[model samples]
Target: MSESYRVVEPQTGVRIGFGDVWQRRELLGMLFQRQIAARYRQMLLGVVWLALEPMAQLAMLTIVFGFLLRVDTGGYPYPLFAFSAMTGWWLFSKTLMSVAGSLQDNIGLISKVYFPRLILPLAATMKELFDGGVMVVILVGLSMLYGYLPTAKIVVLVPLFAYAALIGLGVGLWIATVMVRFRDVRPMMGLVLQAGMYATPIVYPATLVPERFAYAYQFNPMYWVVELSRWALMDKPVDIAPPFFWSLGFVCVTVYGGLMVFAKTEKIVVDVQ
Candidate 1:
């Protein structure tokens, strides 16, 4: 057998090369598999929980908002309406939480090994994408049950899902890098996610938001994802206005900055861990 070597370069200023992560795709795949296994290892239903967890959330939201509050979903069934948005929301929330905690969660492997630290968050994002994909499948079935078959608009969901992942990964990277030192960040993100869910129109219609505050709401990245997703899946009316472009621009800035912060601090932060 031939010996292989990986050159160790002294750390410099912030530099981001995703190509380094791509070259080690095998390691990325391995890490993804390990995360899937560990996540479901102790669970009774295992992979079933992926479907069950989202469905359970859907049921509760339907009861509270649909039955009791009587939130108007433009005559569309509330279960389908809420769930259509839930699919994307679930992807964003899970990816953010998973990627934010990834490095700290794998402290054992990270401390002992020299693989690309970026792979940890990438792997966590992949696992959540898998989980989100399951929710999408269920969404399609749920849509059919409501007598609304998918249209050409369904194709839009692919890019929309990608947009959600970028948003989550962008924010998560910053949180993960900081979490190496400040343990409070994890719980802080938990609270943010809680508030964010309500702030986004997940349980209610965007029409419910007063017209005065609507413009400001459009700047929210989650608002764009959730609203556009509703348009794609439920035929809900959504305008591709200037604010939509602004939200996309926001995502681009966030992901780039997050990558920089993570890359710059990765070496030093691992030491803290």
Candidate 2:
């Protein structure tokens, strides 16, 4: 006689295991679509805000850093230099903030849902990725207007964008997991983001860093993000070899650790007061 084995699904709220997310993929897609629609549904400007936000922020940086601080950018125009760097920085920053606040933002749903908790963070990230694409279109137009013709170097942005996503999501997942237990994390992340803007070379050129502090600076993952972004779009110099490996190692650790921690805490998140 022949026998057939039937597999049983694992209980939800136990752990955010591999099988759990895969089974709930449909719900994730539904949530993603809902977020996109909700973002532009009531607003008068709608999607245009995505394009305007980056340009406005860039203009502010141009006035403050380029003209006020007089941060040198070799020969490339300040607008172009800042735009290229901001592209990567905004992606990381926006995604991190969205994902970090995912849990708190979806309290009503979280209290009632039985799905893998990871979907909230993933959906929040998708929203930012869509917003980032809008900014990229503006970037191309600005590049042409500045008389900086696009070159084959622009191809490198693909990997840099993906690298930024990984780092952003990786860090976000960690924060989201921790925030579920300690509500204080929400306020602390604001301070971190505020400080992170100055810590990175978004408005200024990486060349501005002194030789004495160069070694310590490389430890910052975003340092490579801005460097590679400029190298790709603005024809600026960057030491790609080291940053490539450093970012990859950092991504692996952050993502893996974040997932493991989330899996452990997933069952208890909704119960937290």
RMSD of each: 2.2, 3.1
Candidate 1: C-alpha lDDT: 0.87
Reference-based lDDT, each prediction = 0.87, 0.80
Question: 76-151, model 2: which lDDT tens digit per residue?
Answer: 8888888988888889988998888887898889889677788888888888887877877788788889876889
Worst 10-residue lDDT window for candidate 2 reads 7-16
Q: Please, what's the RMSD in Å of model 2?
A: 3.1
The TM-score that candidate 1 achieves is 0.94
How well is each residue in 157-191 modelled by candidate 1, as lDDT tens digits? Answer: 88899889889999999898888889998778878
Per-prediction TM-score, please? 0.94, 0.90
On lDDT, the candidate that comes out on top is 1
